[model samples]
Target: MSLTLQDVKRVATLARIAVNDEEAATYQQHLNGIFGLIAEMQAVDTTGIEPMSHAQDLSQRLRDDVVTESNQRDKFQAIAPQVAGGLYLVPQVIE
Candidate 1:
């Protein structure tokens, strides 16, 4: 779709961007080019085309799920100012 100078200015204002007359014209051209490309892409017929996750036919290698670190909950809770029933207690801020 073609964009006029006013359209560019309106878009810039909505986006909270400061664009001069020259910049607006440049942006209008760039946006129009992008829209043209989008239009061209939309014109293509992709009937019965299967969607693909990746271009390459490859399977992801996954590592074995195993616990590496030992439990340090008691050690961490020991240093806390206030901890009850294995839970940290914070002061109530709201009434």
Candidate 2:
């Protein structure tokens, strides 16, 4: 679980962070602590435990699916800066 200076440098490069020597040493210590915690978690026995999305036992209410028609095309198109043939238009980008 010990993190080296090379590991800190690699992590800093991957995260796009500029790290000085002192900062790199500090981050090495912090990363070692985090890895130690992960090692401890890996040692725990969870053989029969079921994976769950939430910690609490609660059911989420969902509405029944239904399709409906909407007729607000003109109302919505009126607010557009540019519209043509029931569609919004934008400036051309690629040349």
Candidate 3:
């Protein structure tokens, strides 16, 4: 399927975008070329080809999960204006 100049303009209007005649013609050619490429791709025969997530078959590099910093909760809460039951207290805004 190919998009005509009118189709391009119609799509632009539906999307709330302004497109002049020249721009609509350019977009029509671009969109038609993309559809042609898709048609060509779909014409290829891939009877037994398996789908893959990526082109390259590689494993992701992982790092060891370990604690990197000491506990600083006590140090931070010490400077707060209110604290109760190991939690920070805040004023209730909604009834």
- Runs in model 1 deviating more than 4 A are 62-95
Q: Between candidates 1 and 2, which one is better according to TM-score? A: 1
Better of 2 and 3 by lDDT: 3
Please report how far candidate 1 places residue 35 from its true position, in Å: 0.4
lDDT of 1 by residue, 1-95 (tens): 79999999998999999999999999989999999999999999988988789998799899999999999999999999999999999999999
> CA lDDT, every prediction?
0.95, 0.92, 0.93
Error of 3 at 53 (Å): 1.0
For candidate 2, write residues 1-95 as lDDT tens digits.
68899989998999999999999999898889999999999999999999998999899899888768678888889999999998799999999
TM-score of each: 0.63, 0.58, 0.64
Residue 76, model 3: Cα distance from true site in angstroms: 13
Off by over 4 Å in 3: 61-95
Candidate 1 structure, TM-score to reference: 0.63
What CA RMSD would candidate 2 show?
Answer: 5.5
Q: What is the Cα-based TM-score of model 2?
A: 0.58
Writing each residue's lDDT as its tens digit, candidate 3 over 11-55 gives: 999999999999898889899999999999999998999998999
* Top candidate when judged by lDDT against the true structure: 1
